[model samples]
Target: MAVTLQDKLVVALSSRALFDFEEENQLFEEAGSQSYVQLQLTRLTQPAQPGVAFPLVQKLLRFNADGQHRVEVVILSRNDPVSGLRVFHSAQENHLQIERGVFTQGRTPFKYLRPLGAKLFLSVNESDVRQALEAGFPAARVFPDSIKSAEANPDEIRIAFDGDAVLFADDSERVFKERGLNAFQSHEAQYAQTPLPPGPFVPLLQAIHLLQTLPANQVPVRIRTALVTARSAPAHERAIRTLMSWQITIDEAMFLGGLEKGPFLQEFEPDFFFDDQTRHCESAKYAGPTGHVVHGVANPR
Candidate 1:
């Protein structure tokens, strides 16, 4: 039996995560788009090349309508070398396919970019990805660490997020960022065991959480979550204690203090990462897909 959309697993990829674009660009320009697409299609169909590491993107040339899942490749620039390869692999994968033609002058044609059907396109920047997602296209990055192939079951769609501002109130964060470290520490200390107000996205979190907590036979599809944040060591103890106090179970937790979150995020491979700060989101986006930013206490200066 063919898998339905709800039963199928899907992933969307950005250009940079898919292949070595800078080096391939020169070759792509030399070969021209038409020839390059053909060559890529040929390579995708061949068995995995020897010496290739894990997370290798194999190419496919057919789309399976019954599955309802599809691959979309958002090409950021005209010179993106990964575009052709993405298209080639989509065809071979039997996933529903959509390709936004080159955003370049030549403009390569793709089968899907329609609003009504499954959405797929090439995004040039963070704004582009945001707009497409807002417009209903599922956005994804191509980093190897971003995809948890082992844990991902075809029957479920798993999504994750950070706790503060994303699932709970951002007031504490606002106090910390504006008042300085000491003030922030004091506020947390006062509220040490106290429960803070919930954030705007709490309802969404609850909905997903409800689905996750449902019986396996009742829901048939699983949804998982984790609390990946930068609050570490001593400060981390509070957040951990807070979650325990609330009786919430976070699948994973990382209390990285002032650390670049890309590496750890690659391991989580969440479908989306939502943060109030652009700095963290900017780096996180490179490792995996992200969702709309939820405002925190401090406004961007």
Candidate 2:
């Protein structure tokens, strides 16, 4: 018999995504790992400030509060072993029960997601996030400066996602980008009955759905998910149909068309928001913790 994450919703997080490490990161960038290691060592006893994704992680860990082990959060970082000591210490000081970690020094840690059975990966490193996405994992590069989640709704875990190029494949997004809005609307209208292809975040959504299906008393916190997309009216039908086809229920769906998503998301008050386009993510950061899913047509290199 072995300890298993098979039945858990596993999330792999980078050190920087979990705590405020900008100053140390800057040292690592300008002065290299040695200086960074020294700085982390000196600050080892001081708990780092919570980063953008901190609130979300706190709520997610609540799933395990019922003593069922329904959720697992692991530190998968590029920092060396010495730097990792500070990360663990910060988690302890912050009262987060994060117990597992993998310190890879300067190496990319995305490859470890598979063995960990992680459904989601959140990191501050763009290169690592991109690599995770390319490898078919739902990953996002967290905005370090994004607004923190509100203290209200302590019992609920609110998460929001962009529709096209995030939860759904960017086929419609490609059409919209290449042709005019008329063509994109027409395409979606014609295929209203057809289920849109799944995107990178689909696995993460399914995992959440699974957690939602668990007995209400088995999990300490409630999960509320939303699809906040730019698609409107006629095009929205297909996105709805796609989720119906997958049998996944989104608690809220905002068809914003082309309006800015920031205000709407602020009202939604999600613990975290994910969007493929940097523009949407930029707007969303003002609302709460935002992650840049640098995938699909909008992220052309």
Worst 10 residues of 1 by lDDT: 49-58
Residue-wise C-alpha lDDT for candidate 2, range 1-301, written one tens digit per residue: 9989988889999999999999889888899888988898899889999998789899988887767688889999999998888899999998898989999999999999999989999999999999999999999999999999659589898999999889999988999999989999999999999999999999999999998887886777899999999899999999998999999999999999899999999999989999998998999999999999989998776
- Alpha-carbon local distance difference test for all models: 0.48, 0.92
Model 1: per-residue lDDT, tens digit, 12-79?
33343343343334556798766655555555544222111012222211122234233233333333
Model 2 clash pairs are none
Q: Which portions of model 1 miss their true places by more than 4 Å? A: 1-156, 241-246, 298-301
Q: What TM-score would candidate 2 get against the native?
A: 0.98
